[model samples]
Target: MHLANAPSARRFTGKSNRQARTLAATLVMLLGLSQLAPSVHAQEGLAGSVKRGGVIRYGHFQEPACLFGGWVQQWYLQRQYSDNLVARNEDGKILPWLAESWTISDDKKVYTFEIKPNVKFTDGSALDAQAIADNINGWLSNDPDLRNPTAAPYLGESFESARAIAPLRLEVKLKVPFQPLLNVFAQSSQGILSPSALKRGLAVNCENPVGSGPFIVDKWHHGREVTFRRNPEYNSAPATARHQGPAYVDGISWKFLPDQTVRYGSLIAGETDAIYDIPAVAWKDANFRFPVLRHLTGDPPLRLALYTARPPFDDVLVRRAFAYSTDRKAAVDTSFLGSLPSRATVR
Candidate 1:
């Protein structure tokens, strides 16, 4: 959650390890303090004590293909309309969402979940163990017609079955011990779907989705924007949520602006409260105004694949040379404006 540091502007020069460590520590402290200073002001300022009900106009690079959350990989918009079975806190610990609690068998092959009672989808349908089972097991279904192509890739190949043993109880039996099962369940693509919506098939469900999350899709202007309204009935914010009640905003108006300049302009004009995918070059100009939050990890968002079984890449020397030839530090400095975590490993 650290903001961009102003002092990291100087280019690195393969200096002493002690100097590098000292500079890194200073950058982290400054970045953290930058965010902390504003936060303290906001909390004590008039803005913090004001009553809620304003709509947040958020701008992003792209729009989701559809509203069905459980099938899309990079569909960031879907998360507003749906909730995952579990969630991870800032510290990376798993927490309860739709399922209030769960237990794993000693063998680690069986997962039993206790579904939160009286939870209802936006369509007024109750969220029971059966609905949860259908949403999960649906991904594992091998039936050519019933299987979800987009969701299938996210599910583990060893998935066996998911069933409802009681009204508020669900059992997921795996073929093998899946240690990452909880992590998988925490993904937005594994967000629970309304059973009734699933029965209508993917086409109808994607276009018109119903979930028990904090917000419901109010309108979707194809290729433009999607409007969401807060669900008054939404009482179940995951245990890891920042707060226990509904969202502070009345609703959220998501605008899709692919052009980085236009997005920045919109933010500057105060037309949008937040904007994502801010360009590295824009950081200097953006510093006078809004805060820029970047990912703190070193993992590359994308990778260039080389076929080892093929001719050129098959040679270990060539592969090693290719990897060595790549200027990772320069790329990171130029692309991320030198804000990329220094500790991040380049794969």
Candidate 2:
């Protein structure tokens, strides 16, 4: 984890980042020092640790149409209530999660996963291989509503089938080799949900997709907020997880605050434990008061799409001219108060 330097602050200090890639990068707390889980506190030394079992009032910028969605913001909420087959550590190493360990065939098309035994959904149903298969094969189901938008893209192309040779063993075959499949599996969108919840249909399932994660979605208050409660029965912690048991916080009160200024104000006013991203204009001031951790999402930077199938963009000259015409650096510097990564690709 490439962490931003922490500066001393009095109360409710905050930080901001670019398009945050992981929960760690985005979930910087107002409590100061990472308190996402118990293991992290252990590493930081718990002399000044905040008491466990308080609800985290997280201020967010966007709301997903459903609790489960294809958008990054939705995945952010999903991460609180779902577990993945595998997890990626700060060192960028793959670690076991639902899938204890896995093996790839010589051709690299088939992956055999050794599922962790004794794992059960919050609903008390067993998380067997067939359940895992149901999620992967949702894209091919005749029922359009049953499709998992998050899992379909990767599974649809080159995907042969996912089946259970045994109750706790999953076999997934692909027609073509995709070495990056493991990395994809660790994505937030790939977080596994309970099959029992899917049977409820999209309407109910959207608000109540069950999973064997640390948190359970209690309710989605439309455009207001979403409330989550700690899963007392949760046991499937990712290898990269900060703790081994249920989340340290009792629950999370995720508030949907779109305005950056309002969100930051909530933090300063002691209204929220953490806000998603700090305003760029407030970045310098934020540093002096709070320990700010910024995530520079530039490795795969945001792109400027130009539709070349028609119109002025179809012409190469117009495309090049438009591309180089904008003073993106100046705009970003002024807007973000010179707080983002400078490296960019004009083309």
Using all chains and alpha carbons, the TM-scores for the candidates as numbered come to 0.77, 0.83
**After superposition, which runs of candidate 1 have C-alpha atoms over 4 Å from their true positions?**
1-47, 69-74, 142-151, 154-156, 297-327, 342-347
Instruction: Please write out the lDDT profile of model 1 over residues 63-173, one tens digit for every residue.
Output: 667665444323455566677787765566888888899999999999999988888888888899998888887766875424655557655576788999999999999
**Candidates' C-alpha lDDT:** 0.62, 0.69
CA RMSD (A), model 1: 9.3
Cα-lDDT of candidate 1: 0.62
Give the backbone clash total of model 2: 1
How well is each residue in 288-310 modelled by candidate 2, as lDDT tens digits? Answer: 65555565432344444678889
Q: After superposition on all CA atoms, what RMSD does each candidate show versus the true structure?
A: 9.3, 6.4
